[model samples]
Target chain A: MMLISAIILIIMIVILPLETGRFLERFDKGHQNDTGMVFLSGFLLQLVLFFPVALGTMFFIRQDNFVWCTRIYLILSCIPAIAGAVCRIRKLKEKKPAAGPERKAEVYKNTGEEKNGKFRDAEKTILWAAFFIILAYQLYKAVTTAFIDGDNTFYVTQSLIAQQQGVMFTNLPYTGGPTSLDMRHALAVLPLWFAYLAKVSGIHATVLCKTVMPLFLIPFTYLVFFEIAKRLYPEEKNNIPFFLCLVAVFEMFGSVSIYTSERFFLTRTWQGKAMLGSVVIPVIILALLMIAADIRDKSNANIKTAWYLIVSAGIFSGICTSLGVAFSALLTLGGCLVIAIRDRKPKLFAMSMLACIPQAVYMVLYVILK
Target chain B: MISRLWAYLELNIETVKNYAGTGFLLLIYAAAFAYLLISEKDKAKRVIFVWIPGLTLLFFFLPPVRWMYMKYIDGSATYYRVLWLIPVAMTIAHGFTRICEGFKLIGLPVAVALIALCGGDVYHSVAGPLVIASKAQNEYHIPQEVIETADIIMANEQGHRVKAVMPLDFTSYIRQYDTDLYLAYGRELIMRPDAYDELYSMLCEDPIDVEKMREAAIPRQVSYYVFPKTSGFVKDPESCGLEKAGETKDHVIYRDPEELEYMSGISYYYFTD
Candidate 1:
């Protein structure tokens, strides 16, 4: 399963860039509007990059097929390099600039924005300060909790033990039970990846893994918010970008601390799975919202970005605990529906309903499979 | 009134000293609010921001604050007497605000502080003397010895299985290693017995009678007996069969030969018999 996933990932990386380039060329020549195509192409590329790996992991685990899984995983692991190559190739292909006089005029017309650099610098400073402040705060919480309370000890210990046993999945050491007790159900996907890294590197994986989510989440959420802000106030004069970034950082810090602290008392154990879910669920929801807003803003709504968001949301929802998934799916569906109703766009409503299909299918399949 | 105000101030000071994280967070909130007020182009937004500091000041009057106040002012305080809800409530309020605003500014810092504070307690509970108390029986390795003795008797006996009356939670060790032992008496056998009555009966339950033994099946089967070595057991030996099998630093194991011989192949043992 892993091997299959790897191969699929590689194929996606190779194909997606070419597809995106084609879409962009069509848009530039007035064959398609730029707004919807850009979002659709980006969303499609991301889905193509990530979905196969996630699906392959799930399929292999559920079916208990390790052989093909190993092969698929190796192939998937090459995707980043493959993607880089594809990007370079596309860049080279685009190097022969169009020779039309209209193109030169368009290029010259777009270059008159030198005066905004000072404002951009000020905004950049505020953004960086806020980012660092939040990062420092998050680090302090993670470190103090781990040092004084040792929340990550169990995960670290389990990962170390698994590494020693030379297995990706194994029984937790303290359970002292039969061979039937597998702990894969307790650990999540990202933690498993981190544990694999730990096994290879011979270092504690929990802190690094825990740290990676926030780092990725902060930036990803920032991008989503930036897109939303850009659409909501197209004038670009408002400090929406700064505010959005500020909110993203704050939301991450607050959510992490609350989720961490709640789990600390409730389970009295430090497991990264719960924390990962809390962080991922909110970010994914926000991302989906932004995607919906983007699609709505476009002249010809990108059915593809809407589809990708729906599918990604469904997949993420499926991975989380039942109640969490339910809440998130409901929120995304409701939020999108509300926006569609308020905007009175049948296309938006249709897109939202289409997006919801993946989750409904996921829920039915989940029940059947379980 | 003056004394009360002094008491409140002293409490906040002590809270600052003990939980410096919270203090630092409060300072950040204060600074942010001050900044908001100074930089306010909007009158209503500035007023709203001012409430942030005011709310923090109000948090200083809660029970934990009162306890801290008493501790600092009069040097009298009990651990559990301190109100723990104030910080938790404030943190929750802040979290809600963050959620509403779709921004995390104040909520995140406050949460970090609270996690740091509560995490300290969790760590102390797990690794400190409380851990020692929880594992007193295991540390002395009484359960292992009991299981070994039971295994010896089971090898020699001809019965289906041995019946052993033991404590509840500690029996996991024997069950882990051995497959055919039955628990005749345990916490689950009697639900919420009076302290003295339960103690007296638990101490007295005999391990010899096959009819009296609780049957536990194989594969999922558990063997061996475990009981706490508290004071009441010594006062009532007939019920408990307080005979010394062996001694460890923390507990003593006890067994009765009559019970062992009944199922000649069956044996009963205890880590602290």
Candidate 2:
């Protein structure tokens, strides 16, 4: 049963999300080869879509909101995943297109460009080994060590309640007493997502959140960093492994204080606030980079998709943590304003504002509810 | 308003201090920014690593922006998240990688040494590693005592869902293990300074006032009480209306026979308030 549950969870989180993300690859023609973006796009798609549907279900059908929401989301998600699979099949069948300049550069660069440099294949191998070792150490600690936070009394309990009782926010997680909908936490449905995973996989919610989650969240976070490294060193692929090694080391020793993103990333990987700090924020930065690149190259075809990704990221932030709603918007606006002013494209600012509309709506909802 | 702004600024500074710790990583981050600003030729990389981070640092430090944020967005407690936009790890990694582009042998050792020397070892911090993380005893990652206590309660339970008065330690994990069990008071009532409940105070008090607690709990239909074996009690609970149900390694479980009888008389659904 444990093995079955593990398989089900991997399929739900990894395979299905990647398949769904394959459909989003259509928008960004430049990044067809980028699996990192595909995973992110699909993950965000699920989260962004889940929030409103879950909200609407809770608003309209108070009882069995968990069931209805889970079923609806699962069915809704399959559409994109299936479409992505078909797209993958079609792409596989089509005649091989000649490698573009960028693709050719990616292929040529990782190997021969650094022949004369001090960093050889062996050094690169060492860097790669170091990176994997760091990752393994973190994962080992995450699995074996039990880091108990006071907040888990609420968050983990909430997921368990939703999974076992099939109710959303109706039961107080601390005790089994009834509660009115927690307007603040209800909007951030990360716990509900956990509940859905537990319910589907038949894994205990506590075990899943504490053990299985970090396994995915840690590596998934690194996947985001890997994509960032790729972007930072598009030409110097050798540096990519070293960059990742640095990142892993930073995260390892990042327990500067309890408040740092690094501490939260390692200690509270399953929590919504942690995801907001680490994943959602980095994603916004990645999207901004992609958007800026698209604009500079006059690549409007995929640029809109990148901007739309910002929009989706806004909603995704809200799904992860309520504070994320504002943080993502502020970050987007800040980055976009700089881009707009630098490039003399005022429309970029407007597009950023448009991207923040969902977050604006969520904030307004919070204010009204508060 | 000026005073409020000053207070917010102090809060922001404190947040930065807490985030920066020994300031070594932040210094590395700053050095990375300088490197990127000077040498990074790619327009996108410049925007991402240098300009955006610079603007974000400015935005984070500005008191007015923080005031507006605390007032309108969320609260001051989360204002530190504004710095999350800076991409500290990415910048440091990129900068060090860039600076060491040519000298692999020296650069790798230097980078690793700098990180080790400057950074706090997470596993050996001020509180010690055990406080942060210890080997989980079970698949649930719950303490063995908690699982044992729950097991005892579950074994003793009749058809009705168990409504127990658990100590503060057990209150959190018990419900996570079994939703059918309810607590008399929760973590919120204790953790939140402003909230209060008499039953919680009386039941959880050291040298627990048994008669007063029983008088208070009987009306609420609490059927069990699980406390640490070392807990001080004014009187033995079994001498009162309760019976010694079972024991775990660390906890003594007691059941109110009268309350159980009372609860069984009425058909109670687990979902009921």
Q: Which predicted model would earn the best DockQ?
A: 2
**For residues A1-370, could you state the per-residue lDDT of candidate 2 as single tens digits?**
8889889898889988898898888866766766787887888887777787778776677576788878998888688889999998898789574363453433444455524344467787888888999999999888887776778888888899788777787777887756677777878888998998898899989888989999999999998888778767766677999999988898878777767788788888899999987898888887888878877777764575577678887888888888888889988999999989988999989988988989999988877765
- Residue A249, candidate 2: Cα error in Å is 0.8
Q: What are the per-residue Cα lDDT tens digits for candidate 1 across B42-90? A: 3222222343234434545454645554453234332211212112222
- Candidate 1: true interface contacts recovered: 0.00
Pairs in clash, predicted candidate 2: none
- The CAPRI-style docking tier of model 2 reads medium
Error of 1 at A261 (Å): 10
The estimated TM-scores of all candidates read 0.45, 0.92
Q: For this target, which candidate reaches the highest lDDT against the unseen true structure? A: 2
lDDT of 1: 0.39
Candidate 2 chain A has its poorest 10 consecutive residues by lDDT at A100-109
Which lDDT tens digits does candidate 2 get at residues B68-181? 887777764777778877888888888889889877556877887888787876654443343666777887878888888888887777435768887787887788787778
Q: Give me the runs in candidate 1 sitting further than 4 Å from their true place.
A: A1-71, A77-84, A93-120, A140-190, A199-234, A237-241, A252-298, A301-303, A322-324, B1-273
